[model samples]
Target: MAPMGIRLSPLGVAVFCLLGVGVFYHLYAGVISSRIATFRQKKTVDLRELLALSIEASVQGGREVKRIREDDSLQEKTKGKTKEGASEKLTLGDLNSHRKMFYLFKNTYPFLQVNSEEHDSSDGEATIWTPNIPVDVLNKVPASQMVPSESVTVWIDPLDATQEYTENLPKYVTTMVCVAVDGEPVIGVIHKPFTGHTAWGFVGQGANVAPRESYNANNPKVIVSRSHSGKVKAFVQQAFGNSTEIIPAGGAGYKVLALLDPSDDEKPDVYIHVTYIKKWDICAGNAILKALGGHMTTLKGEEIDYSGSEGNPGGLLASVGMDHKKLVSRLPPWDQNK
Candidate 1:
């Protein structure tokens, strides 16, 4: 006659509620983690494709030039425009690639609220940048330096080693990105599309090349730009002496990787470039090398300020597993006038 009812004791009810909450939390955490991983994987794929597209464009431009040279009629018709066309094609390809990557990052991480200020670009194109993720969110940077993520700047090198790419040295070309918080590199990503190899790192989190390989302390090998070795040659001789081997490499990013993963017969220990360089050219490599127990600074032993102008007039000196202070001490004082 009484209404059918089932009532559990307080203890039983509490146990049931606790179990439900635990299960829900587990599922939620799994989904969040999965989403983050998927986003990163997608970003890597997009970057690889961008690099491939840029390389293809460059190769095609070269072929077009060759065809023009081979055919007299074609050469005559394109006389004034041959050089211009090739340069424009490469430049346009790089610009388009940059735009694509910018959009991808913007769309994928909408929460970051990326925006481009007018001052960010001189060519009138939008300069894309996102509000920095908090230091705790990154969890890889020192809290003192990175807590105010608003000061962080994102540096992207759509295609590094432009000269190498034009010369058909695809292996040296790479797409690189770095996040610098308060003028210190906190994260970096470098992707070599030709080889389909990607390396990434964060400040305190170390790098993909954890437990970096050992190197010879006495004979420290140095890497310099293959195309611009003349200027560095004298400095290499002065700092490392005539005996220190100088390895000719194509891109800064590639050279940094070599410093981390040297050949069986050779062990690269330093990368020195004493000339005007752009922020994008070195940011990614700097971050990775720093994370891997190295240091990158100016010839005067000053750390780079990423937030300043794009041009790095101070020159760069990077060393792997070697005392950067000791290395700087070996070089003569830099003359700004020179």
Candidate 2:
């Protein structure tokens, strides 16, 4: 064996090593490409699954909101008030519900990016949320392509209508979840704890509920914030005529629901808010609107981008059955309203 051995020059050795490296790279790349092709099929959730998960999470959060309120354990307090006498309150319900949902999504996907309204979710709550995805909700979700985990941002408003919640108005309280994909709201789940009614919507997929048929879009019944009507009342009244019927309401979730309500007398034609509002306050509503062939945008009629800042500045107008552009065109500049 020693007598049969042969030696190679330095250049030959270098070429041989280079060839070996090229072969190894080709093999590794083939395996990786094969895995990449089957990744979603073998080991990932579809958009529908995430949508159902969101609905379940919202329902659980809503349950906590109602249970905490009924037990008289909410223990509400004024967190702070803006210079405009607009007070923001916080309750134990808010903290617990958010903690419940934050863990709910985190534990399930472990990769979702969640933007919550509550900033005090440092402590862990006794994880009471079950991973039960509602069968009805899952069945209703339309099948869709899977997105990369990092492209989705889940926005949570654990307790909407805090003031109304403190004031014993259960109808106005809601827990909301919005899943925005690549800066666009694609799934929305808004649950009213007091009513046990859940509304879920996906951008391309229609909602479970439908808008009423009897609505007169020309007359346009508008729903606005009860506490922060501010100059919005005058602005809406002027744009839609004096008889347009401006209904004061609480919570972005409630206002959006009012638009989708089937009741003839109660359902409003539009939801308009003329003030700087947080993204979590309206993201779910906006998705719900989009799902129903409706749309929500700045008072200036610009579509909102949810990937970046948390606050939406130029006010908002959400409408179904009416021309959003035409409606917004009628309104004056947002700055001039005040």
Candidate 3:
């Protein structure tokens, strides 16, 4: 027993050393798993060809989105035909019209994934593209069946600016492809196909025009809806106070890009998804924002968790400036029913 109290024997010493190594390996394994988990959670989407096709179709089909937008009665008739009896709201119009266009474009442009179910209400629509995992299919697949833990995962907001598109505002509307590495965005491509212009951004990797600067500077620009409601306007006013400059952009994607390294020097410093900001509304933009060393958190400063739900909480708040604490602080509380 080697005096029982003091184990000086070689066997005892070896056992203790082995235990230490085991503990170290356990911790090391945990770290590796964390990195792996982060990587797997990263998300992205590719809309280059699809966007071009959409625009091309829009060139012929653009008249349709615009036609319905201008003729309220046409919209009402289209929605009334739906099983859900959608209202005249822009989002509903978008779903019904796009659903129609999908059928129209299917024979000619079969690549746009028109067969997927329409997951829109009076709020918005969520469609699936087959090339990338259909959201519905992704929901069914277990995490284990997904790519390796070190691989990246992305969610495509195929038609991000549905409202803008429905409103005949392709300038504000855009298509995006964003990729994230280890839960942080690294690559982003936002294309305003109508104008044949695109803005790209990167993190730890910089873009052509985006500077490593605060998100908000003088003349702080804001992208707002062309058809804003009084309630939303009042809320925005309260949040930013008077003398705030707002630049109207057609789509949420345009708004997000406007906040940071905007294609137009007149882009805004902040992007606010005040009401009904669905997951599709912010997914691609979130990928880009995070890529530029920026963040899109809830008003209370909590990191938003995507890949878990298609419905996002209320609206989102984001900025390229780290000093955007005021936004949350001055937030005008809202209701979910809206």
- Point to the candidate with the largest lDDT: 2
Candidate 2 — which pairs collide? Answer: none
The global C-alpha lDDT for each of the candidates, from Candidate 1 onward, is 0.62, 0.82, 0.51
Q: Model 3, residue 9: displacement in angstroms?
A: 76
**lDDT of candidate 2 over 22-41, digit per residue (tens):** 99988798888777765633
TM-scores for the candidates? 0.63, 0.82, 0.53
lDDT of 1 by residue, 115-229 (tens): 2210123233243333344333334433323243345566766666655665566778777777676678766777775666667767666555642467655667788877658
What's the lDDT for candidate 2?
0.82
TM-score winner between candidates 1 and 2: 2
lDDT of 3 by residue, 73-163 (tens): 3342232321123332334434554454354334433322232213343432233233332232234222322223233323333344555
What does the lDDT read for residue 331 in candidate 3? 71
List runs of model 2 lying over 4 Å from the truth: 1-45, 83-85, 121-133, 142-144, 336-338
Lowest-lDDT window of 10 residues in candidate 2? 37-46
